[model samples]
Structures are given as C-alpha cells and as structure tokens.
Target chain A: MRGLGTRTVLYQQNVAASLGLYNNDLKSVDILRETGPITAGELSKITGLATGSVTALIDRLEKVGYVRRANDPNDRRRVILVPEYEYKEEVGNTYRPLHQSMHELASSYTDEDLDLITQFIGKASAILEEQIKQLNVKKSKSSS
Target chain B: MRGLGTRTVLYQQNVAASLGLYNNDLKSVDILRETGPITAGELSKITGLATGSVTALIDRLEKVGYVRRANDPNDRRRVILVPEYEYKEEVGNTYRPLHQSMHELASSYTDEDLDLITQFIGKASAILEEQIKQLNVKKSKSSS
Candidate 1:
C-alpha cells in the first residue's frame, strides 16, 4: 500500500515535469478541476500554499492558459479560479493510458467486489485527508 | 480511485512540508528505503532527476543526516547512498498514524479480499510507473 502511494507521487511528479509545471502547481490544478471556481484564498487553503505563493501559482497557470482568474460576481473585490476546459482535455489525454489500463483491471472484478473496494478506498482517502489537514495545521503553527 | 490518488498526493505533500523536505526529496528517500544502498547515478535514474540535481539532493539529504554518502566498495570513486536507519525510523514514525489506521481498516477484510485488493493495487501501480517512464522519456527527448 505504501508502495502504491510512492508510485502515485512519482507518477504525479513526472506528469508535472512533462507539462513544465511544479508538482504542487499540477496538484492545485487537479483540485481546481474538481472544485470548479474558487477564490485564491480557498485554493491556498486547499493546497497548503501561502496566499502570496498562490498568487504566483495562479499567474504562472494563467500565463500558460491552463487556468483563468475572474472576478467573483457577488463579491467584485474577490477573484476566483477556473480550470480551462481545453487545458483539462489536454492534460486528461496524458492520463488516458493509465485510466484505460485501470478500467480493464476493474472489469475483471465482480460488481460486488468493486463496491467493496470502492468503500475501502473511499474510507482510506478520508483518513488520508484528515491526516493532511492535521499536518497543515501543524505546519502553519510552526511557521508562525 | 482518482480521488484516492489525489488525497494521497496531498497527504504526501503535507508530510513533506511537516518534515521541511521537498515532496520529491521525501519521495527519493522512500525509493532509497526500498532500493537500499544505490549509487548516486542509480538514484538519479530511478527518481528521474538530473545528475546535477541528484548531487544537490544528496548534499541536502547528507547535510540533514538522513542519508550518508560513501565511496562504493567496488568503485572507490563512485558515491552511493545509504539511508541511515535512524533517519528511516524518524521519518517512518511520521507515517505511523496513517499506517495504524490503515491496518485497522484492513483488519475488517478477509484474507482473500485483501489479496484481491493487493493484486489490484500492485497492477495499478505498475501501469502508473509505465506511464511515468514514458512521460520522462518524452521530457528528455524534447529537452534534448
């Protein structure tokens, strides 16, 4: 299981390198794609990047046309990020092979077994997320 | 599954932050732990980092006492990395809570189910590694 996690990290870093972006930058984009439009502050919170760093990250991403920063209609002073559809498609292509292979792997399992696996993975991910939050909280406290 | 992967990445990024290490540095350590005493060149190849960057990486890890650089027994001029056992234990401690939680989660499953899940994850990791290699190959080709 730890081997699986290490491989996932390596895979993500390689993907980020392939796209000429930092691993964290790609990770931010990953979050944005799932989250739709969100404030820079929200992105910072989610990604564990500081506000200033998040601004730079958004600039670099915007410069590459992978993301857009637009004014929040309800709060004109605020800006929100949106992952460009084209950017998502282009990056999604790079993942196609892996997804295809995984899909095939899934096909070999019974639906009952798949449900069991899904439940296990979902619970495990929740555990990981809780741990990540705690680590970030600790990081902020130490830095301050 | 993708959600699990994303959380894993975020969890690892936070872990790296908590330890004052780059995510890649921690990742390199993870690989070194698995591979054991490998040459700097071998570590560079395994981690997809340039030789110069690998040198710097070794310097940093050595400075922190997480790794030691020594001449290879068979080739006195070549430096190899040996992950200090103390370093491993310290870093591994940071992951113990997650491990404990995962172990508890696993305890709920039958051995046959656990075997199936392990096989799936192993295969998925292989597919991911293959894709990572291809991306790295493409990156090098383009850079050259």
Candidate 2:
C-alpha cells in the first residue's frame, strides 16, 4: 500500500511538472473542475489552505488561462471561481494517454470482477480518510 | 484513480506535518527504508531531485536521527545512507493503525481475489511509470 501511495504521488508530481504547473495549481484547478464555480473560502476549506493561499492559487491559474474569478451572482460582495473550458480541454489532452490505457485495462475485467474491485477500493478509501482525520487531529494537537 | 492518488498524497503530507518533518525528509527516509543503503546520487535519480537538493535532504534527515550518512564499504570516496532502525520503528508506530486496518481488509478477500487485485495494481503501476518517463522527457524538452 505504501509503495502504491508513493507511486501515486510521484505520478501526480510528474503530471504537474510536465504541464509546467505547480502541484497546488493543478490541485486547485482539479477541485474547480470537479465542483464547478465555488467561493474562495470553500476552496480553502476543501484544500486545507489559507484563504490568502487560495487567492494566490487562483491568481496563478487565472494567469495561465485555466481559471477565472467572477463576482457571485447573488451577492455583489462575493467572488467565485470558474474553470475555463478551453484551457482545461487542452490540459485534458495531456492526460488522454493515461486515461486510454486505464480504460483498456478496465475493459478486460468482467462487470462482476469490477464490482468487487470497486467495493474494495471504496472500503480502502474510507479507511484512509478516517486515518487522515485522525492524523489531522494529531497535527493540530502537536502544533498547539 | 485521481481521488485515491490525492488521498495518498494527503496522507503522506499529514504524516509529515504530524511528525514535524518536511515532505522531502519523509521521502528520503522512505527511500532509504525501501532500497537499504544507497548513494545520494541514486536517491536524486529515483526522486527526480537535483543532487544538491538530495544532499540537503539527507542532511535534514540525518539531523532528525531518521537517517545517517556512512562510507560505502566498496569505495573510499562514496557515501551511502542508512535508515536508523530505532527512529524508523518509532515512526512506524504511527502507521501501525493503518497497516492493521489494511491487513484486516485484505483478510476478507479470497486468495484468488487478492491475486487479481495484485495483478491489476502491478500492471497499473507499470503504466503510470511509463507515462512518468514520457512526461519527464516532455518536461525537459520544454524547459530546455
């Protein structure tokens, strides 16, 4: 599991480096992609970064044409982030090879087998998430 | 896959923060744990870090008592890194809960199912490694 985790991080690091973007930039963009337009505060909560850091993150992404900040529709004082579709499409092209390979691999597994794999993965993720929460508590306690 | 990858990175990050160690320090210690004693140059190659950065990384870990620098027995000028067993064992305690959970989860799967899962993970890791190599080439080209 640790080996797999290390490889997973290295893979993401390479992906970010290959695109000439910092890891946080990619992570922020990915969050925006998945959640759609959201407030800067919301992004900070999800990413565990400070609001100032999220603002800087958004600024960098906007500079690269990957994201933009817009005023909230309901509140004039509010601002939200939006992902630029065209820019993300271009970035998506870089990951096409990886997706294609994974899809091919998935095709070999029968639906039943895939179901079992998915179940296992879901349980594993839950375990990791729980552990992360516990670790965060430990982190906060030590810092305090 | 991306979600798991993100969680894996987050877990490592939290682990580092909880222990008051930097990310690279844990990474260097981890490399030593996995590969036994290795030269600083080999560590740099495996981690995609510059030689100078790797030297600094080793220095930091050595100061933490997690790793130590020693002379390579085969060559007078060469140096190797060894993980301090006691320090790593103490660190390992933090991960003991996680290892126990995973072990329990694995116990639920049949041997055949476990074999299938292992095969898939191995194949997926190879695919990612290949993509990383290709991405590195692209990164270098663009930078140069």
lDDT of 2 by residue, A31-130 (tens): 6777789999987766666579888888888898988899989898999998884466657887888889988988999999888877877788778778
Tens digits of per-residue lDDT, candidate 1, B1-144, equal 888888899999888888888888888888888888999888887778899998898888888877898888999988789987444655777888898989999999999999888888888888887877888888889899
A1-144 in candidate 1: lDDT tens per residue?
888898899888888887778988888888888888999999988878789999999999999888999988989898889888355665888788788888998999999989888888898988998888888888888889
Worst window of 10 by summed lDDT in candidate 1 chain A: A85-94
Which residue pairs does candidate 1 place in steric collision? none
Error of 2 at B25 (Å): 3.2
> Candidate 2 at B118: error in angstroms?
1.8
RMSD of candidate 2 to the truth, in angstroms, is 2.6
lDDT of 1 at B109: 94
**TM-score of each candidate structure, all chains considered together:** 0.93, 0.87
Judged by DockQ, which candidate is best? 1
Give me the TM-scores of chain B across the candidates.
0.92, 0.89
**Per-model DockQ against the true two-chain complex:** 0.81, 0.60
